[model samples]
Target chain A: MTTSPIADALRLPAGPVDLTAIETDAKPGFDGKKADGKGALFAMGDELADLQERLWAQRTVGSERRVLLVLQGMDTSGKGGVLRHTIGLVDPQGVRITSFKAPTDEERAHDFLWRIDKGLPPAGYIGVFDRSHYEDVLIARVHDLAEPAEIHRRYGAINDFEARLADSGVAIIKCMLHVGADEQKSRLAARLDNPDKHWKYNPGDLDERASWPAYREAYEIALERTNTDVAPWYVVPADKKWFRNLAVAQLLLDTLRELDPQWPVADFDVEAEKKRLAEESPVQ
Target chain B: MTTSPIADALRLPAGPVDLTAIETDAKPGFDGKKADGKGALFAMGDELADLQERLWAQRTVGSERRVLLVLQGMDTSGKGGVLRHTIGLVDPQGVRITSFKAPTDEERAHDFLWRIDKGLPPAGYIGVFDRSHYEDVLIARVHDLAEPAEIHRRYGAINDFEARLADSGVAIIKCMLHVGADEQKSRLAARLDNPDKHWKYNPGDLDERASWPAYREAYEIALERTNTDVAPWYVVPADKKWFRNLAVAQLLLDTLRELDPQWPVADFDVEAEKKRLAEESPVQ
Candidate 1:
């Protein structure tokens, strides 16, 4: 597993995680400007594609290995952008992406992880969660949706759940797209200006924006508590959309390379199949 | 919808559909060579991306309208390739792809369309079925997996099912990727030759290849029986991978243009929300 400097720089350190200390607009490890970042992301496509296919091919041999990307962020932090730019590099057939929304009555009835379990990638898939179980703590804490005791307990429950997933060969990459309040204001205004983007805007977003400080505190607490070895969080500086995409793409490529999934060898005799095809099934 | 000459030429006409009569390698309705074909398919990307977004946005307003592309082809006919090259053009978020393998015990216990119902795309999404319910007729007829009486009944059942989907706002584009015998042999041989592709090879594919005549006859019968006014089948010549991808992309583009999903209007007062963001939510 080759090391990536960006992954190291962005990976949350063990102890308290402060969102204010992280530079939201700075490109920490990437050197070039926007065009170069775009080119770099696109360049990673081939290797990323190859690794994804290899991982997908593991299913043919009944291997249970897979990768899951959990994306958590405030609205307008470009979680959707990462999905389009980063995860889009690979074949969609090999991908299983689930964007979690507000819970339905059926979902709210069960433990939070119940719906999460249903969305997990089967063997050999690269699964992505747009907003994940982390929301149970972030939003639940910020809005006091759940009891204080329940919300506190969810942090440990999430770590245990992710640990079990890792034991079963699911490599989890958790990203917190950390955008500043000022950057988010501009993004929301832009969404309002463009009719094409209005569908993405929710009036309720203003209510959330009003609670930025609370959300930040909620996020810091969630990150510090749930940052486990099995699924550590990476706080991405997301004020620059291009850099955010590039950083996430690099993170995905690094994880896939570390997994180093091999193309499965033929289970049957190759030579015999070749001869049989030539002799018996010669196209009529 | 803009007229696509390819769609006109490929659309299975009313009457008996004969797979043998179509030229597998011909690039009908395309004026250019291979490089031009690739360029054209890539150029379609921007428009495809925009149309997909608009279709996806429709869900914000509770629109059930969506598009479903059904790909039915023999092994090595490039169903996976179409998924990678053609369907891969849109954001994977809006596209729900289901590659139907053999039914599980539960799936087998129910009627064939039962599983298909579970795979339908929700509001504001584009769904692709790598292989779909057509298999119930094609594979069922080829191997006599079902009784002749049951196989005959399935054709009508399929048409009824599709008509119901169309009524519920599914714009269906069913494509039958048509590859010839020599082409199939070469493709299967190529799979055998590449060690990296060994995982894709199955000895059972050879058994299906041996029954080429049976599968072709089954396909012809199924195509003829299930071709509906609401959901038409287009026989895509699959010997040339580029042309197959180009044709399917054009078919999809044309369908989306016809749907002409408008960007949903903001349900909230935009100016009020903008003011609220600027005033009440001024960056903490």
Candidate 2:
């Protein structure tokens, strides 16, 4: 039951990833329509909260294990929406979200992974990267921010880095939200249509949209290059926002269930403590 | 309608404050029972989400305003419960929650406020401190960690620090979750009884419980000394967990409604961008 078909279907296969071949609007593993999808997600909330607490409780037993969710997508791919609707289901205290914008000068001065290393979740926490070190490859390759050799080297470096994280007990979930060009245009236009959404629209999103083809190729290159067993990639069909949220959430749920974090046993003498409370700590 | 009677009723008045005089189980500003209280909190979710987004959107327009909610209380006073139930209502992205534990060597090396300054929310965010700078006075006083004069000086230092934060547009909400000693005994007993909750129990909590009177005196003195116009303290009767959650959520809602953040106006031409998107960026 922990095995989600969505995870199996949406997971990028070992050989190559073609951004064009996947139908952007297709609901890959879900059988029903929108309402059912939402209801299914809603039903998972209690279990999600339970599993997250168990994961968080592991820290008390000196477990360093944590989950880092890396979300990468083109503009208007609904990363924020997923964060609010999906990750928002759990207690915010147990979740740490870091949204990476353009690197600050201090960040640029360090290795691309340095800032990311700093943002990693602590023991018993779920760390989310809205955009992450993958940017070092995706945007770096697209904008030619680094030399060709350096850009080429980042792929290996990322793999090695994630491998170390895996060894040290980090469950990495990498998602590439795959929205079609038409979908992107409409989402951007909707930002223009609504005053409440204008804050989310950036003119630079247009620049990124114009280079959609390049970005797709860059993603394909990055995804194919760094798709390791430790941190595999999921190409969520982002044209449908609900499906994107549900898939990511289901992916997280599946992972948590697999981890199967158990509540830590009491280190103290529970019976003795209970006795002490009864005797020494009477109602005041 | 924007104002909450809960905020006004819970807010500690300007004068000598007495923790013992307050009833820990009484529901102030709320006439309903637990189910109705939970219903009221659930009803506030949409407004909370909307207001949080407005506050978050302010960052787009270069607004520096943010709100900081500092929760301080004895063990099992339900600070964690409030965080899970109340602050959990809004988008976690817009919130920055810091749980202040015993100071590290590095944290202790720096001025007390240095670590606190580092934890402050960035512009346009709601920052929550499960335990905060007030620990300097409360714990320092109880354990005699600092000189008598040094502890006295910290009150002024904290007031000045908050005044500066207020001047820079940080609306501060400090809540002291006042749970009675008898209720705390039962809660501690419950933690000892449940294996699932054992991770949350620390044997040291019993030691702290033994020093309850000292801690209460410390809180009383700390509240009296540092409570200011810039950052007032609200004594939330936390014996009823539902009321505690609802009251704090309402306080946040009241503050957000007062700020009444508007969605940022787009700096770019909406019509022109729509045209460019439609013409240049067609479906692939």
| Tens digits of lDDT, candidate 1, B45-71 | 999999999999998898999999999
TM-score of each: 0.99, 0.98
Give the per-residue lDDT digits (tens) of candidate 1, residues A137-165: 98998888899999989988999999999
Which stretches of model 1 miss by more than 4 angstroms? none
Off by over 4 Å in 2: A281-284, B281-283
Cα miss at B41, model 1 (Å)? 0.3
Pairs in steric clash, model 1: none
Model 1, position B176, has a per-residue lDDT of: 90
